[model samples]
Target: MMEYFYPEHLKKMFTNRKRELKDLEYTRDSLDKGTLRNISFFGLRRIGKSLLIKEFMYRNPGNIYINIEEIASSPEFFSLRYIGYIAYWLNENGDALPDDYMEINALIKKCTEMNIKALTDAVTKLNLEFSKEKRDHNFLLGLAFTLPEKICREKNKKIMLFLDEFQALAVLKKSPQVLNPFALFRSAIQNQSGTSYVLAGSQITKMRSILEDHKEPLFLQFNVLNIEPFTREDTYELCSKILPGQDTDIFESIYKYSYGHPFHTTSVCERVKEYSEKCELEITNELISQAFLVEVLSKEGNINKFCRYLYDISLEKARGYGILKAILTVLAEKEGTTITEIARGIKRSPQATKKYLMWLEEVDLITKYEKTYFYKDPVFRTWLAYYEKGIELGIMPKREMLKNLLSNLEEKYLRTSSELGRAKEFETKVKLEKKLGIELKNYMSKDGQIEIDLAGKKDALIYLVEIKWKNKSSDYKDIENFLKKTEKSEFSDKEKKLFFISKSGFTSSALKLAKSNNVTVLDRNLEAIEAVN
Candidate 1:
């Protein structure tokens, strides 16, 4: 009978995440049918994992959401909050209870007043047990975790329990009486029929250890859902909502700088709105540059604070914090560097640096691919570049310094986007080759005036491909340009097959032109291209 409340502003700001919502709903429906599949959501800090959970909880009633970090000061405190939240969530017209009713005494009294005998008894019993001189922490944890199932079964209802920052529960193991809290928790909920758990945490390393490491108790117990950054389309939609009347170019600039991260995108958009309102000026790339600099470099900025927290907390959790910091600094300065280069920068041996890099990787601070390492979040890397240099807090940077930083950022964005585009093009080429059974390579004119992303030759036909890995659909103009380029290229004499691979599909006119001209258009679904001889 508890009504969950989602704020109006949040509802307005919430963008497109229909797929994630559907996934959550599917799990909940499965649980309703007497099958429980627990889920654990993992993402980097400020990646909107918590917001997604909140939105899900708002839509779905009969749920209890607890942020473990806020209450998990000790085993005793966590036990009380666990029981209190369940009681509060189950109470009839629970909104009447004072905000602080989650306190042990308030929860007990509230439950008793509501004549919720099941929850009342459970809370009273827990309070009495905790007060005992020789408390059994294991028994207390079991009782706290199982109370929801017990109460829900009595009421002939089901409950979804969302634990944010669930990895914080590991701290309970430090208590002598509670040797392994995760084991106790898994044991309690392993066979529960009435309650399903959804665990989420920002600490990717700790969460992975708890849920994926075979040695851990909760290993493989929950379905893992990774909360990724918003897509470019979603980012544009969100920015449009925040700062209306902006052109596509402004929105694209925001997406390019934010990289579709909800926090970054929101921060930049909100900052732009502020500047536009105060100065009565239009939103431009220059304005975006100033907003981004303020958000990432200003001490009071939300993004700066978040990055600082991420930097400090990640180091706190990893071993050899000092060396790990050095390795991160090295990567922030020059990403995609080899272990030997990193060792040279950090003044450590390659072997020692590799160990430190592994520690950073474990914390999800940096990732390794093909023997080189890069920061998992490029925005964070940008922040660190200034942070490591002791960028003064709350001081307006010199114009030259700001220009230089923005220039570097623009360059980095172009470089990273190009790299990603190339990777996608390569993937598309491989897929096309497998589907059509043809070998492809990059093709360029002798004067470099026209370059094709991919080209292949098989039999009498030469394939010239133009790949558009962008947010917008390939339009008639794109197809026209490709045709113009082909007409001027040396391949004009050869019997050439044309391919247009667009990630966002093609516009109506583009499709019509492509079909008429016998140009195979491949979207994300490359299977359609197989029909092309």
Candidate 2:
């Protein structure tokens, strides 16, 4: 029973989520005015959807929270079960019920018995107004709608109800008795006033089926909110708190591996701290490598959990499990590839491969850019690459997955690191432009050979930026090439101000030479390595 993210005491120590919190607050306010349009949002599993909604419920008093997945498929959810759940939650203040209690309890019992004619007769006996003609409709709907309405009226307060993993309830639609239960609920609850209802689900495709189907009950009824990863600043701030005294490079490595995924970041940080302390070593590149093997390369690791989630969901969506696996294997074996290339890898046609690729994109497991598709999380892609390698070599047992990791390490690292470096430079251009208060111009030579990460000017000087996100620092040799390019008469008038950005900083000699030549070395700290003017 080891807890993730530090310890039991620190479980509720939420990190940077001000934006989502503000948004939920706005949602509650709008609900008070009945102006909020969206009631349902979708996100990937473990992307903190439940945690986010639960926290919002805690903040907004009188909010009722239910994880529908727990009782979704069972008869308990359809019976008077939800009424009891609401009653229990209300009694948290230890209060007695109103005077009409006997009649209410009787009605609840009649509703639970769930004979269509009997329930219809009970509704009439009670003189309850029908929301939708009151036929043999959803048994759970009337009660769920009534509870919130009653709570708001009796308690003299508005209420918010958060239903997490609501897609699980779609299972009930397949039943004969309550066909299209979602529409029934929509009809009942949409009429109720003074209560805000939020619905959320994890499975992207299943959720779309429930909420997006044109013929379905809840189609486009709920608003959508997608919770994304923390920004680099938020990620860095969190790492500073979790791993005090760790250098900037260490923090960058944590972000790089986790890809700003909250669960992944916390899990990796916790495990890194655990193993580093156990081995009596400081956190370093080498130590992180060891931690990745021991903590995540194991069968029950977070990496395995995410990979399995991807596999299961893909199986559900794709035409055939073999084709889906082949597509994932192709992507995992080599990323940034086209459908044609992937099809060729799996010996399938491009048209056939495109279906699986589109399905993966629909599930948010992968993203398509121009003609190439890649896993959203680069680390996940890395893990899959090695995973396929292990399976290809017939490596048995989960613990033995890392047997050939060393053999595959150098080349894979080189390829992935180079890709990340190129991506980060593009990001750096934005960061530098914002920090310097100017936009950088981009250009390519007529021969399409020359490229620039960033080329802008400040006042009367030219700023040429280079970003490297690798273990080794940029050396004097790198600056030497820039010096040669600048020697052209193209830059004779404007002074050259070189801004060399490196995650690992520059060599001492590079710093010395660049200092003499007016070069600005931006070390891992993102601060200038000031060469004394």
Candidate 3:
């Protein structure tokens, strides 16, 4: 069994997050120059929000980090427990850090070694007049936020406080009427001269309400940073770190499985490594696929917990859980379905289904693009597909269950792969027209037996386009048949031109035939065809 990732282990395993690091550096520079405006970061869970913050602190000394997820569990409700973390940093870094701008609270000073309740007791012992109105959230937040600002103020230094899982403050609400400690944070730091904050969270709805919602306290007040997945080059680098000398196909398989999600990428790769160790199996496509299934379906504690977290958040605390589950199934099984289509699938009203989609979207389970909705996590969609398909076969026909199951997964992969093709085709159409200077329209034969991916007329010449996405290079026979059929059927008397686009480059024969027949070939970006002209 592999050892669990500890802090030291993590520091080694960390992949390059260039964009996120650059963003943090920009924030620091802006703070020094006195132009920094926003200080909040949001991303999907396990997409590495916490990891980024930790890496920042590791790289830069004199920074204080606290996980709000910890304070959320304290019995004292809300208090200045984080002051202790800063005090520890102060003691550890000493003059290497900025001098204390103000007299450190005796109680807050002990924050380095004591519990939050003990720290609160020190506040009482000192008889501080922090809050005469109430010792509730505002009062506690006032004391906590002040120390960091003062540290910044007198020394002319910027104390970077990283609050991980910051949306916990939104969850820590005691009552509807209680003043939000989060807003207290905004008010405290908005005008403060010396402090910089980096608030990070994974709860999309709560975090958005705290920072993006119009009526919320911190509405649009935070500069939000989004951490995207690793690029292809970075993903390859990460894979190499795990297991070098692997085939390029292995890395591509991981990339397709992870779809650029950081955590999923790491998890699947690690599990694949384990499988290879135990079974001495070569890293084949089948090996990668099974590793993915084992990790996603595993009942091991942390994996189970993570899956539960996904299920709970995606359900958004059971607001129409069953119906929403049905909705999710539809979204998983059919990519790019609108609310109406999902509603029809689940036998619900479009309006009701739309409301559920809003919740799912707010929770970051799915994202809406124009008129269609898609699972934000493709691996999660794959899991759902497996479950739904398993139930449909009713144990399968006797002994062929394994074979049938493999067939089902293959079909799911095809559907998922087809989604990429659809997106590529649409993008290619726009690029070809923009780059080559022509207007393209979706062309379907009236009989519906034949169709062109894109077709349009440019003055005296009519053009037809076919965009094919396949693992293998496209061949001449495919293009030849399309041209012959269109010539004989619709444009026999019209002067015509044909363009063939492929994700994989055309075969030698395909290129030769296309050149001799006045056909142009381009890549997905419509780049190569300019040379053909």
Q: Count the clashes in each prediction.
A: 0, 2, 1
Candidate 2 structure quality by residue, lDDT tens digits, 1-533:
11321234443546666656666777777777866445676776666787776556555545666667765663223433444445434433112232221244654554445433433343453334333364333554555546666556555566677777887776666566676667666876766566777888877667777777888877777776777887665566677676777766676676666767777777777767776677566788655554555444566566666765666755674567787777777787677898889989989888978887887877767888989988776666666666766632221233344445644654553243334454455456657888888878554333334555567877887777666778888888987776666554355467767777888877778888888887778875568886543
lDDT ranking, best first: 1, 3, 2
CA shift of 67, model 3, Å: 1.7
- Report lDDT per candidate: 0.79, 0.63, 0.68
* Residue-wise C-alpha lDDT for candidate 3, range 374-448, written one tens digit per residue: 887777776666655553322112335445555666676434433445445555666789876999865655444
Better of 1 and 2 by TM-score: 1
C-alpha RMSD by candidate, in order: 11.6, 12.2, 13.5
- Those runs of model 3 whose alpha carbons end farther than 4 Å from true positions after fitting are 1-6, 73-77, 92-136, 175-177, 300-305, 388-404, 413-533
- For model 2, state the Cα shift of residue 34 in Å: 5.2
Q: Give residue 231's error in model 3 in angstroms.
A: 2.0
Identify the leading candidate in terms of lDDT: 1
TM-score against truth, every candidate = 0.78, 0.65, 0.68
Off by over 4 Å in 2: 1-11, 33-37, 93-137, 208-216, 313-319, 391-533
lDDT per residue, candidate 1, 98-182, as tens digits? Answer: 3655677777778867665677777888889878998878877887888888887778888888899998897897888888888
